[model samples]
Target chain A: MDSSPLVLTLASIILASTPLIIAVCGEILTERSGIVNLSLDGTMLMSAMTGFVVAFETDNVWLGFLGAMGVGAFFAFIVAFGSIRLRQSQFAIGFVLTLLGDDLSAFLGQNYTRIPGPVVQHYAIPILKDIPIIGPIFFNQNVIVYFAYILVFVTWFWLFRTQPGLRLRSAGDRPEAGFARGVGINFQRYLYTIIGGGLVGVAGASYSLNIKIGWAEGLTRGFGWIALAIVIFGGWSPIRGMFGALLFGATKALATYLQRTFPEVSVVAFNAIPWVLMILVLLLVGSDFTERVITVAPKSLRRPLQRFLKISPPQALGSTFVED
Target chain B: MNANRWIRWVWPAVPIAGALVVTSLLLFFFGAAPLEAFQAMYDGAFGDQAKTLSVLAFWVPLLLAGTGLLVTFKAGLWNIGIEGQIVMGAIAASWVALRMEAPSAVLITVEILAAMLAGALWAALSAVLKTRGNVHEIFSGLALNSIAIIFTNYLISGPWQPPEGGTFRGTAPFQPGALLPLYENSRFSPLSLLLAAIAFTLVVIALRGTFWGLKLKAIGQNLRSAFLLGVSSEREMILAMMLCGALAGLGGAVRTLSWFDSLRQSISGGIGFMALLVVMLANYRMFLVPPIALFFSAVLSGSITLQLRTQLHSSLGGILTELMVLFVLLFGDWKKLGVFRKKDDDG
Candidate 1:
């Protein structure tokens, strides 16, 4: 009933979603290059652990972020390397790496568990922080949150407005066509995959440094899969992925909020709300189901509804490009 | 012909040897003498009857999971939700084991069936989502795994907490009648081992020799062609997933009913993913699944001593297995990498 509680909740939602927004944006970029890196969960866990450990050691959160990005990019590079050079299944290698990375983080991070690390310092923008609801919601946050906000606009503009962005989209959609126009298809895939992976690392770092604020076993706890799902839900657009991330954050917040009132509901079961919602979202957005729904939908609603939910991934998303 | 035969035998061996060298390097990084850590691992696995039985006990769930994964891999379906399936099976079996008031034999039968049905139903949900709902199995599986884990955690820490109190340690030890009886007070029962061994043999026989197995493989390889050749692709896929789910379910049921006193929060304990590694390492060869599962279980059992004795994390065992698979991917297919070529399509 109170405005302050609503404002604080709104602010927390934005704060919590910063990492997911970064992760989904990274995945959008990677998938746009026609490579699907399914190692997000493991990558995030490993990088989060590494990031926290580095920050704890160095007494600098930025260094932690850098270390995480490097770790993430390295894992992503291997996927691209295996898929492009070794001619292995991207899904297989990525899957194995996810498991390996997760286990490895647990192994290597034994010493770092529960130890306090340097945290991302909050910075409230001077003039903007005073601007009523908007200022309290967005302006009064850490540098990472600000960076995430900026990243949304920057990536969206870069993807939709820039010439290279068009070429990147082209590479994913029809690499053969891109190749005909003199684009090096595989090279682009490798480049974007690594870049996206590094971004994913930063997202992981944000969890330890800014959001969750520490490392633990199973840190992130399969939340990376949520980011992956958000990418599809976002229709693979960086801006839309940010919205999806926010939506997921809102769901988590709602679960936490409702848990306060409904104490009888088991906390663990309530915590599963986001996942259940995601599965439902995927079911509803599914191609065949949507087509059926569109048929039943009134004529006026069908177009807008289809436009809202129809998600067509990059054409060469998983296929290994072999020159004929 | 002689050279070709030689390459077939030697090629696989080369990568394993390469993996040994790489793993030794990793051990050195872990600050344990490579030879010392490996020796400890060997001693731990075959140290005594107790240790060896422990390894076999570990192998039971692994082989159960691997056999089910075998079918899915052959069917060209990735049942990544085996982890959740395993958990679901345990949940169902636990539900019966704790609540049922029946004769021991009847209880055991119902427990096993419940676990299998629970696992099958969970997997079928994913399959239904895949076939009818247009959701990819991977996504649905991933989501379900989290949901299942949270649900299990709730049951353990919420409603089903032992009379003592609610805690994450899992439910208090099940009644003796609900558990699989131990043989001579060993960590596991002989009957459990026999069951896994029998299941493994049957799965191998069915996958290699049966027409049903061939059809699953056919559907996996080319669904359109298989359908054209009079295969029921959709129904068969669901059945394949269910069979795999049932196997994983049995893994859970065995672990609950016999293997352990009670379910831990990490009841599945990453065995689902490990089984995937095993099946992949075996190159989808059902017969190879047992040895590979055994090898992994040995590595896991052995690594416990590595942790206690050498101060290395037990996860080194998992890391070592992963490295071997990576090496196999690299060096097993060195010829494909054009390190050397036979100039023939046979390889």
Candidate 2:
């Protein structure tokens, strides 16, 4: 059963989604702090380039990850400083940085393109890897993938089950209230944004060193945008975001499966699936149609449905918090 | 008054200089000579008549996209789906060109109209999604943009494959009647430039001299208050988006008919996104659109040669432009500068 195509595909899907899972986690934290770092696409591209280059030059994968985290934090710091202190438009600056990061990565990675670099070593948990189908699908992966799994639960716990989490939520939802409670709103925004950006940086490094394994122009190009969409689909919760990432991975795997099964089908057609899914998933959460559906449902189903389908962005997601 | 005039000239220069320093430092870090790269880029963009004309040809579509964005920006809409509008326009024009056979003048006129209508409809989708479904235009626009590209790929590869076969390049070059007349064996079309200029002038007038422009300004400043003042925010927002889409569609038509003479993949080639950058760099000002768009066009065109001469990546132009916009956003407000604050305090 473990060697069957179904199990193999499921295993690969888990492996492929690690970066996206990591990226969504990062973005959730950032957006929760009332900052939208729309530069995820470019940041990932630049950091992917940086990660590969540093690893190649230093012959150390850990250093590459560190360098990437630093780069990510630096970019997020700029976003935080500009939006929080300088009071510029977050979207505009983020968009510009996306374009800049793309170009900068291409220009800087010119020499690094297609060169062999350090690859993340795989380490399956000894006992866990032996635990039937689930073991092979989840536990039998590289350290980065394992780290992503742990990060998801940690993120969920940090955001929902802690005292600091309440302050963070207040920082995004009601800055005035948070300020009244003596929270350093700006400082919280900066700290969380940088930390989230560093996680995104890890996602980028994961791509270059583990999943994709080389430097190239536009390496991991559209994934960042997809990750952004997934953050919305997940309704700003890390646990839900992980499922969104997995669903995206499953669709991609299905596309690959279809292409292999039906060679006559143009592969380009399948490229549209994730994007179309992005629209549909967003529609599901963004519209009040879900609420209407819940209204018509049985009482027992309605509560569970409401818990699952409810989606609302942070009140101060894109606005500058001017504290008195 | 003289100092104020001088300050206006000098202030904008700050961001440009900052961009230059940052780009130069990037080059220096990468072991490339900044001066040499800049020289190469300049030579590549304006080395001769052909290069200059190429820049102008590129400028026409970019200028149109930038001009259209002024309307949406005035109404406080992002309209990022402008890229899709351009793509839909190209597809519409392509459909007419591929299916309809008529005199050149009639065919061209119909194609342009079809392109504009298609673009308007596409933009309208995002607007409706926002007003009715409560989805943000940014997300809807992005989704629609992907759908447009997917539709293009499906059409070119599946239904509209060339007579010989499909290599995914594009439909066979359109009949002469379907294509815009070129000038001096170049892809440049004088008619498209004229159309773009007309669009620019009309938008400027619409934005500066009309009550509609005032309403849009009111909406942009505060939508709730604008609604309270009896303005129909929904209708105006939709109209602004459609207007921008129409202009962008014309840009796509220009691109397909003049730039490549076929409905090719990636036909918009980031022109719509570049237009977003151009408008942002212009600080959403109307009159500044043309010159800034032209500058961006020149830089991009020059980067092609800069790649060959300096062995640098062609995205060097994108980096330079993006940095300028970034710095401007960070420090563009002259009143926020410490020196100006002191001056205001003295006054």
Candidate 3:
């Protein structure tokens, strides 16, 4: 029931990060399946444009989401087919798709730029939103934000708790063994990649339809790469990735606050914080130096340090899959 | 063997045709005439002396960047940090032009050298991260790219603001001596183009005739095998990246000194990225780089007029090029086409 700047900023941070949370979750799933969908930046742009345009024309928001998801799934299918069936480099295919998606969005969305469109109505959960700081920040948001909250936990449960999740992990971590066990490796890759891409599409729709509220050239440029970085920073765990998104959101909020507070300062440089943080976080997690430092630490500190710092990727993240 | 000779020439056309078809369908979907758009683009690129000169000016930097990428690609490294290298090159040249006072020729030479050094050092950071820290070049390169852009923002807004005020547009124009000698009113500078041409020749020589080139190929093919054969893979990779960065930096120097009078925000303006696409479309063939880069430059340069004549987004240029590269990569394999062969040979 409060309108304090602190509460509002916190709420806004959560709202802004919803798209990233969904995207990181999707990319985490894809990479967990040993497929790196590097087309996230372009996929997000294309879907945002498609979501906005479809929603604008049909006057139905859900259809927009569906259309966006279809676009996402199609792009992912290409990646899966190229890497899995044709044995082409996933990075090469993904990079091209990213460019194609960007250019396509700009060209197609030309007629639709800056146009007002249907928006997702705000809804607050009566009971949960009544709580203190946490409720205002988490529960007092739109349906997509609510979905993002559930999605992270659901992703964690799906990856760790379910049998199918175990098979998915095996597909990415050890495809040969999985195939030997008759896991239908390529099929799982295609299925998960598409599903993950659909979620990414939902993230894009959330941006145009909910958070940012308009389509433009490069509607969500650079954030997709940030999500990719956060996935690594999260160690490919949905929960950790959620935290990474939140941290990025907080930095952005802080940058905006600083710019407003100190009118003379050029905080445009602050836009680079997420990227700089990306490198620093990856270095902390991915570098051998950190491992050595953890080794030299006190024995009691070593366990927690290793637990905190362990961020290895799936063993077969970018390689082609072959059926013998 | 005889079939292969003709196949190589024919193979290149398939992707080109596929690209045209896809772009045409896209234009038709949007209710635009595809042929009209293409004609507009062609005219824009070569409509007159100035337009063609502009295309050539754009081609110089693109050619330089693509030439550098050839070295990195040969070493099996994706030097995506090249965008940052180019930016860093511009900043270094700007720093020299802004602060140093010297003879015209000496200042130009020093500015270029500084730009090359700065670019190489920036690229070396990515190389070091890959080799020493085990961070992938893609991620590091992306991060470095952002950092370089941010650094430019800081310089422009804070320290390097023009004498009049802080517009965030760019620093003040350099002294006449600091700039490359332009050809009439055009952005094209014969010196810069000559430099690009020389860089291309040197790279071709290095890749074709030198032992270092063979070592790079070995490292690219199989890192473990190369190491087993007494080649230092890490050092070679670093050297390759630095060499690529140096050439890319030269491109940046050309961009700032000749293309524009001063260092502007987004100085390279996706030229570095376009070069990456150019090299990819060229299939990493050194010989294909120049013509392909020139084509890309013309397409992009012509897209300016495309936007005016068609009321379409200028990204049509990007769309066409990306589609071409994608189709080429997807269908380039002769066995996949099955045009000249009957059975699919499983690799």
Which residue pairs clash in candidate 1? B180-B257
Model 1 has an lDDT value of 0.86
How would you encode candidate 1's per-residue C-alpha lDDT over A1-324 as one tens digit per residue?
124988999999999999999999899999998999988988999999989999999898999999999999999998888888778878787887888888788888888887778999999999998888999998988999999989889889988999888878877899999888878888889998999999999999899888888888778867788899999889898887888899999998899888899988777778888888888888877758688788899999999987887888899897777654
Which lDDT tens digits does candidate 1 get at residues B1-347?
68767887788988788878877887787688999998999989989988998888888899999999998888999999999999999999999988888887788888888999999999998888888877788888888887888888989998789889987989988878888767666667777778778877787787889998999999999999999999998898899899989989999988777667777687898889899989878878778889999999999899998888998877788888887776676556765665555556433
Whole-model lDDT per candidate: 0.86, 0.88, 0.89
Model 2 over residues B1-347: C-alpha lDDT tens digits? 78877887789889899999998998788778999888888988899999989999999999999998999999999988999999999999999999999999999999999999999999998988777667778778887898899889988987888899997898888998999988898889999999999999988888889989889988888999999999998899999989999998999999999998889988897888899999999999888889999999898898888789877777889999999999998888765544555544633
**TM-scores of the models, in the given order?**
0.94, 0.95, 0.95
Measured against the native two-chain assembly using Cα atoms, what DockQ does each of the candidate structures obtain, in the order listed? Answer: 0.51, 0.53, 0.60
> If the candidates were sorted by their DockQ against the true structure, best first, what order would they fall in?
3, 2, 1
User: Residues B1-347, candidate 3, lDDT per residue (tens digit)?
Assistant: 87788788787788789999999998889778999999999999999999999999999999999999999999999888899999999999999999999999999999999999999999999998888877778899988998898899889888999999888899999999999999999999999999999999999999999999999999888999999999999999999999999988988899999999898988987887888888888888899999999999999888899889988778999999999988887787765555566455544
TM match of model 3 to true structure: 0.95
Q: Which ten residues in a row have the lowest lDDT in candidate 2 chain B?
A: B338-347
Tell me the lDDT of model 2 at B65: 92
Error of 1 at B38 (Å): 1.1
Instruction: Give the TM-score of candidate 3 (chain A).
Output: 0.97
